[model samples]
Target: MNKEETFIKDLVVLTPDVFEDARGYFFEGYNKNKFSALGIAIDFVQDNQSFSQRGTLRGLHYQNPPYAQTKLVRVLQGEIMDVAVDLRKDSPTYGQHFGIKLTAENKKQLLVPQGFAHGFSVLSETAVVLYKCDQFYNKASEGGIRFDDPTLNIDWGMELKKAIVSEKDLVLPDFANCNSEF
Candidate 1:
């Protein structure tokens, strides 16, 4: 396995071992024991999968403390530009965002620890993003930063007209003005 550092301090990119032959390909997609060896004792409680077409921007969302989550995210069928933003107010790297390309071909994964919001945009004709969350979803604790927050200035690699989002995402607070729930 290999690791890559992002702009954010603790966020990391992981490339796991993939076995391939004339038949097909396989990999230990997520191994608790292996991750535990790396000092990550993630007790992932939920697994999620989303299928989206190119230009679909899903989130920058997080649940508040007590229900805040850490995630191991990767692409299963195509490609996506994954993003994570630090939200711990007392942390040195607070408010910063990290991004990476997670694709089926690369077999790369992202380690997004708690105290951060995560999101992604599909970069291929279509994409299937799989994620393991340490916490279950909590509606009341949910919070998010707008996908186009100027402070984040994330180039989802597509213009506004081409990108897609839900009504809730349309009114998410900007990073600059994000509250304690941020």
Candidate 2:
């Protein structure tokens, strides 16, 4: 795996080496030893998956401290514009965000550390995202910022008016008003 650092501290993009043949291809999506060698030693306890259609947007979400999660996210099928925002109050990149295109073709994965908010927008006809989390979900600890928060000024690569967002996510607080405990 090749690790590349994003502008935000501790956030990384990992590209795995793929071996392809006429019939198929192979890659080690995750190997404990390889990941540990790359300095990512989190013991993920849960795996989550989601399927969405094009223009479907989700997040700018994070879990509160004590239940905060570190996620390793990738696309299993189709494509998406994945985003992560640093919520660490003292971090240099606090409030800043990073966006990248993740697709089955590229096999790129985003490593979002605990002190960050994450979200993604499906860009293909259909998309299946799979992610591993270091911590389990806690409804009481769930938190989120609006996907189109003015303060963040993220370009979702599509028109907001056409984006299909959940009612809960649609009402999330803007960046400045969010209670980012991280």
TM-score per candidate, chains pooled? 0.94, 0.98
lDDT of 1 by residue, 23-127 (tens): 998888788888878767889999999999988999878888788888899898999999888898887888778888889999999999888989999889999
Candidate 1 global Cα RMSD: 1.4
Model 1 score (lDDT): 0.86
Measured with C-alpha atoms, the lDDT of residue 35 in candidate 1 is 80
Worst 10 residues of 2 by lDDT: 173-182
RMSD, one per candidate, in order: 1.4, 0.6
Question: Could you tell me the TM-score of candidate 2?
Answer: 0.98
Backbone clashes per model, in order? 0, 0
Q: What is the lDDT, from 0 to 100, of the residue 94 in candidate 2?
A: 89
* Model 1, TM vs. native: 0.94
> Model 2: per-residue lDDT, tens digit, 64-157?
9899999999999999999999999999888899999999999999999999999999999999999999999999999999998988999988
Per-model lDDT:
0.86, 0.95
